[model samples]
Target: MLEKEYDVIIIGAGVAGCVAALKLVANGKRVLLVEKLKKIGSHNSRKLDVTESQGIADITAELNLPFNGKFNRSIWYSPNANFELDSRVYDYYVLRGSDVDSFESIVSNRIKSFGGTVLTNAEITNYNFENEYVKSVVINYNNRHQVVNCKYLFFADGHHSKSLEIFGIKERPGPTFIGYGEICVNSELKAGVTHVFFDSKLAPGGYFYLGKADNGEVLSSIVINKALQGNISIKTYYQNFIAANANILKLLGKYKVKNSFVGMGKTGIISRRSLRNMALLGDAGRTMDPIFGYGVRQAIISGYMAAVSAIDCLNNKKRDLDEYEDKLNKSVFQGRETENQKFRNFIDHLNNEELDYAFKSIETIGLSTSLDDFFDNPFNNIGMLLNVTLKKPKLLTTVIIKFFLA
Candidate 1:
């Protein structure tokens, strides 16, 4: 058990929570980071995230951690065709685990160094809300209950967070996908290379992803539409994805499943970002790229932005932190949910043939889009988008025309 009260209490210890706590504690505030897991890196949620920024490098350099998240090549494959993006600049990725070089490990291990406390195996079962402002939380750990009060609260509770359900907050839902997959031994996929497969049959509205870590472990997963076109089993889709990608399988080494999991991938964005005393961070607010699933960068940015907003609010005697929402709106995902939702819907209706055609067309044209530039709201790359869509004008639904041209 840590202190009874603090200046700030964070509900999660993932990337966002750790970053927020680091900043707050660095500013000389008493901070507590609570994680429901038994240890910092023991949860499935604290895994790999293909980020848009150099969050890994920045944090690692600041902390003097040896981890480097540099990647060289990225491959995008349709069912029938594929395209490649060769970047000598930087295509970032962050691995989260107990490894010394992992980003989560690097940040999480330094919580106490910054004068912050991390309580693992803790569940915040209840929260006391007064006049729509959060006052405190009921923590369950070691079969005992304790109440802790704090001046400000952060909900970095992740994608499957029940905080919204408990608070009865309605989330603006997007395409929900059933992400079913496994971690396997890597013998083929070169380090610093990633593959994204677009197949309506395998992933439906979403896509299948396979990337190898520097430690020779490969993560192969597919996000398929929950309401699939055919009444096929998700298991079949997973197996088919593996079968189709023979290169992903261990050719020389014996194939083995390191771990397996099935979970829901929420593409929804919560419109209401904060209350007077509580702020939502990370996937709880769906601060991510809906199409490409780039979350870690957004999560880190939101955490830092929220910490800045918290400092301003606390200095003003805990006044309403309406500026938190404004900050979130203008930064991170940058209030682009409407545009992302439209793009998601547009891609959802696209069949396998259409996707293959789009890939071929991109191969014909070229990807002049930079990772960082496109990360700052993908709508700015409308010229490339229009070039592909104009090839098959019917693929451009009326909704797209009205949204863009209008």
Candidate 2:
């Protein structure tokens, strides 16, 4: 058995944990980052194929850091509209499965360069908390037991976070959905644009996306109503999906499935209060707008914000966790709440009549934008709709009174 102490201890080594460790160590605080997986980012079900750079643009701007790399903008589909999305707006750079090894290497190298310690395959068994504050954590790594004491603990352990449960934190329910995806090489599809197919028959309560990787592989996923109910396996879903979409089937002619991934179970809007001595980031804190399925970007941002708060608390000699909570609420949760309500309203009201009206309105409006554009700037999209209504008052009244009215 071994014992150690640090200024901060972070659990989980996904992108969130890595970003937290980077922030803390860069601020000159000693950090011990532990991951239960054999390697950092191994458990991440989301492949590092596209939108890596565009995912972090906002944070890069805020921090005045250079994160520019090659990422391609793609289209996103909504039942109401098709949008052309620019990756820069989100700070994520798209890469292929072949690029994942290099990307992980770069992240690992960055951590070491910033003077941080990373221990993999270390599973946390229990935590010692006193007076609502975490004092230490017991971990078993490589057949050895150890205890790590720290002033602050950040849980980036993700949705099924055992740490948050142990700490007696309850997750608030919101919009939830489930789905799966895969990577297929030698695909006949072009390697760039993202194609989203929305049909209740295929995915039920969710949507499907087919993103082309840089290496001529297709990265696809389907979002469904909760994880367990989506009994359909990835293989079955993909085969059926290809059969249903004529365009997709034509593009995927004579393609072989190289690598496949499945993510089942409910993923939805969940928010938890960031507590004292302990803070949750990534999926452990809250999920992104499930409708958009941008959880990875949200995780990275939350992790960075959590680290900043932790550093402030440690440096200011304040035990109050309110500051961290305030930052989180003001930044991530507030926007999420609004979006959640709006999407819920939209989904609930979507029927054949509403869809017809929306499609006609979009066509008459003659808006020269894709679904990705609408999703990237929802407020602007709403404004556009309002402008259209102002010009065609009857259309606006019919949409609101017929669809929105109870």
Candidate 3:
């Protein structure tokens, strides 16, 4: 028998895990949140001064939670043009880069305030199963092994989750190497504008980004995609990019070094979302946009959805948890996961010259604007897609065929 039991057990106290805990408690369920790290939300992504997408705002309104995250106005600097996002798209705010650490702290405290249990430095080493359904989690806490039973389990442990394997789900595939690091600049960028650089030379398949906090601290980073055949190492790319990119160097006239890191992740979306009573959320589920690795909003959405599914399953309100995947595909992805996949495939087929040409065409056609402005009604702008197809008929056809075949 297990030492303790709860209505639900959520692993990984990141954004998704915390949201699941808080929401589950609000629905009158006992929740235990487990984090393997000593601290919550202290991951490498936090150090990058990233912005929260508009989906986060929707989650806040839906949940009526007191938590408010500050997001920043952003600018996309392509090889051919530079433009800022139009704020009129939705009620989005820019994240003051300095608030990364505090945001995690606030979420952690909110979970506790709502009577949700959170355990740091606690890891789920294994699980106890009954008839193929996970009945409880075997956790290692503070050097002691503990058995904690629960009706449902949430695996939000991120991109490299072992629980996914335990659940018999095949792993997703992606880039071979991802390198990210912070650089301080003497000069200040736009106060609220986050800048993204998309030149292949700088990051090849990935991109580079920079954002400044209200306090004037800037965090610059480079993510290298598919670094297997690269001549230079990931670190070399980072160092060379800083040294070679004049604009970036000029921006960093004088600055102090803070921290840097490199990691790998699977870029493909997960095929299996759940096995019996166990469900995957966030990176563990591979819900990122793939094109850009933007998952904060997706993470929040997955957590909220998973919590609802868990509650419904435990209460017999739903026959099974299969609805969780269906709901996510319909609601969060808006039935456009295939389109996004096609976009990724199309991008993969392009060379540097083609990429530059595409960006140039976007600027020439007056389509260049804030990221939000374009994505606000992306598909509605069929003219843009048609225009691109007209420019590169062969590539567009291949992308479409691949999507259809898949």
Candidate 4:
């Protein structure tokens, strides 16, 4: 069904967009959520994100929705199992995909149940603005363009948002990220844990992770830079990488892939979060934090914040939504960008041989550490540096020297 007007129009229905809509409608506002995809959730990336923050757990608990699992352990697996660090991780995991029990579906269904209208396979072809406020938006649906009136627009449509160029808005450019993932049934992986592999041959431009294998299903995903990977295709490389790993083979036993998905996006935050009454959240803004391997929690937090701010503005005659960016800066996004920079630098400075040595040093110390330190602060940890220096002096002489030189 189509409506003549809505109090707010939300673009995209991922975790961020859906949360925004849920909050708006729950606050007694009319919201129209439009998605170009035929459905709300990711195709088949179940247990796709293992977050390292408790911030997002609030939203699930608030909605009375249970998360998939709580991860208390993570292993930073080095090349060839030469060295690995099994450490403590304080975070929860969420299930993705179009399944009824998935986070995306649950949040989306809640919106509709609360009187929000969701139109899948819909695209915003054109829009009109009155002064600085949005007047109406044109959505292309069912092979026809339809117009609907709305006072505000919120776009959580990823880094390359559809609404950006239309308003002459400049976006913060970032790396082009491509990912491939799949889920298989009857796998032999233990739940409540995760593994991150950082080998160049295994995942050239990026890396791969295997975890959250539970209830007869396990998720496996790999990321790579095609140009960096050279002649081999990502699929071929991924297939071979998975099969060649003895640990993965042992875990697989006998299994069949049920569903596969391809994920593509641009990294970094949006340069302009709000233009007039339009605002961007999620990947459109800067919800993707690299250190944790995923940022669904951050995405959900950003969406909820955007929703609350918009509600206050729409209900109380406020019009300074540009301050949304400022709010984000003080909240979830605070200081993390710098950490992300350090993490990237650390990754860039390491290869297979150096990585093995670093993990070997960590293993020697018997430090039950959360990877957050390495990804969030790199080698800046004083105690860790001291221990590594005394335990693996050669690692400090070689890898540390190279890290500084780069």
Candidate 5:
């Protein structure tokens, strides 16, 4: 029914696509950002009521693109134990059931401020490529089919992205999980701290988080491992979780469930390359390190990097997209691979004895040990484990040394 052409066509108007459009537009390129949904940020974007603190604030600040918003500090809790981290590490926690329109409005305003056009309710049916380069895309919007040509295409369409499949990209298998969350208003809980309850019974290999949003609403979520192969409903899981964790239920006693969100996907380590003319960003690029499950920051960073690489290729008139590979290697690939391997190993060998010893080590050495120092550098963790094993031989010997030591 309609046809148009632009310098770039971005599929999926979530954070990654929006960020890419913003960067591309800032670079003086005309972009056609399309979304299959009726509105932007309706999928995983809507599911997020709170943004977790990532190392991005510093990185973005360095790039002179600091997010213009207020952040509230919060806590993180381990699901399997009573361990509670009282650190102010997170940047902000969104309240449950916050206004999706308001969030989209902010993002839309930012995109417009950067001179980008957003197209919602536009579902891309397929892509047209020639000589290993993207040429155009066939789309359906409002009961009509159309084709839009573009010089470049960027896919940020979440985990099971349809765009990637059209471009001949496949995702590697990895661990997965099913998760659900809700936002409650007018609760008795404090307005700043996030509470996590680690209950294996309710979440299995996953955990739950309860936090106060910037607007003083409560957001709670339950993440469960899909590897367990159970047919338990999210509603049932929430009920069981509430029954076990009285403190959370008590705080949320009178608050109505304003919004319920559910997501089912692979949450573990999945590997895929993004080097073609049509680049893949965000969850489509890699899915790993669900420990924090902060795909937003990853999406933003990857989108920025992809745009930069694409710009370089265009300016240099180089058909080879090797720089994108290098950027991903440095920023995502290697780090993600290592993190995923480490997590898999850790989870495989984790048991009561090992956990007890690890906790004891934490108690003795304190939490000052940097995450990098312990995980990245194998020798540091080995030394700590050796110390614990020597003192508590009974507890340490039962654990797998190779798993944690590496």
Candidate 6:
């Protein structure tokens, strides 16, 4: 059994776990960071580089943390027209496809420098609950069993967290399949532009992307909203996507597949991100965006928020940990859950004809609207919608009905 009782015990060493440990230790609390994987951020490896939304910059500035991630502008291609987004826009930043390891390593080193203990190859097998709070955890480290007790626990074990079953926390449904791979092509692709296709035939109820990596490789991905586990494979989807997209074929006359990976994303808004003495962080608590599986920023924000909540409870004797969930939902989702759900709902019920018409309208009339303007008023755009309505009234009517239904 471990002799030292930490003030807080954080499971998992991803962005969220590391951030939590860093914050807790900085606030004079003894923290132990534990991970089941041999190394942190190993699950993040893929042919595609990492891309974060504008939230990462906001988080670093707000928390005063030292974070410098390289960013390049990217383009989002709708069905009909391509929307160019400036680098300064608060939408997203495309990280070089090759910086995944270095970025994670930097954060891990930062946590260690703060005097926090990190245990790799550690597994939390069970939990002992005292009354309504987690009292201690049984961990297996280096082929030895040990009991680690703590006043507060932060579970960042990711989407397949074992802590949820131990705590009896139910998970809600979300996105299921995301396939990533790298391909080398002998053609000149757009430097920073990320081509996104919403064709259902390519990626049913989801999207596909083709972007350039720093190493002069093309990183292509097919992200879908269904489960691809049993018999379906990512290669099958990639083949279908290539067959469906002419632009991809024209852009890259011949390509070689280098690597491939499959990932799952489920959108579950846990009503409780925390219990009495413990809280779930990152994908462990289902903090991913419902519309898109963009979660690195969410994971970071949740980790920081969980740390803040733990510190507050530790400093104030009268404070309760219930505020963690409330603060987390507000800070992370920010009332975007409902809006995102509406978008998902529309997509769920949209027929292929309606979707094709919508994309066509965007290609025809969407050229007038900028990316920022469209996001600001995606549905209620009078000028753009009116022009599309004049061309095809049925398309606009179906959109309105779907909006209300969603």
> Tens digits of per-residue lDDT for model 4 on 72-116?
676777774444444443666667778888888988998999999
- Tens digits of per-residue lDDT for model 1 on 129-220? 77777778899988899999988888998888876776567888776667766667745656777888888766787787777666666667
Kindly provide the TM-score of model 4 when superposed on the true structure, using C-alpha atoms: 0.87
Candidate 6 displacement at residue 97 in angstroms: 11
Q: How does candidate 5 fare on TM-score?
A: 0.83
TM-score per candidate, in order? 0.82, 0.79, 0.82, 0.87, 0.83, 0.85
Best by TM-score: 4
lDDT of 2 by residue, 99-130 (tens): 34534445555677877888888888888988
The Cα error of candidate 2 at residue 161, in Å, is 0.8
The residue pairs that clash in candidate 1, if any, are none
Which regions in candidate 6 have their CA more than 4 angstroms from the true location? 1-3, 47-52, 61-73, 78-82, 87-100, 183-187, 213-218, 227-231, 249-258, 336-339, 363-369, 378-380
Error of 1 at 315 (Å): 4.3
Candidate 4 residue 360 Cα shift, in angstroms, is: 1.8
Worst 10 residues of 3 by lDDT: 89-98
Q: In model 3, what are the clashing residue pairs, if there are any?
A: 71-93, 71-94, 71-95, 72-94, 72-95, 84-370, 85-370, 174-267, 186-254
Weakest 10 consecutive residues of candidate 4 by summed lDDT: 80-89
Give RMSD to native, each candidate.
4.1, 4.5, 4.3, 3.1, 3.8, 3.6
Give candidate 6's TM-score. 0.85
Q: In model 5, what is the error at residue 91, expressed in angstroms?
A: 3.7
| Candidate 3 residue runs with Cα over 4 Å from true position | 1-3, 49-52, 62-74, 80-100, 183-187, 227-231, 315-319, 367-406
Model 6 Cα shift for residue 18 (angstroms):
2.2
Which 10 successive residues of model 1 have the least lDDT summed? 59-68
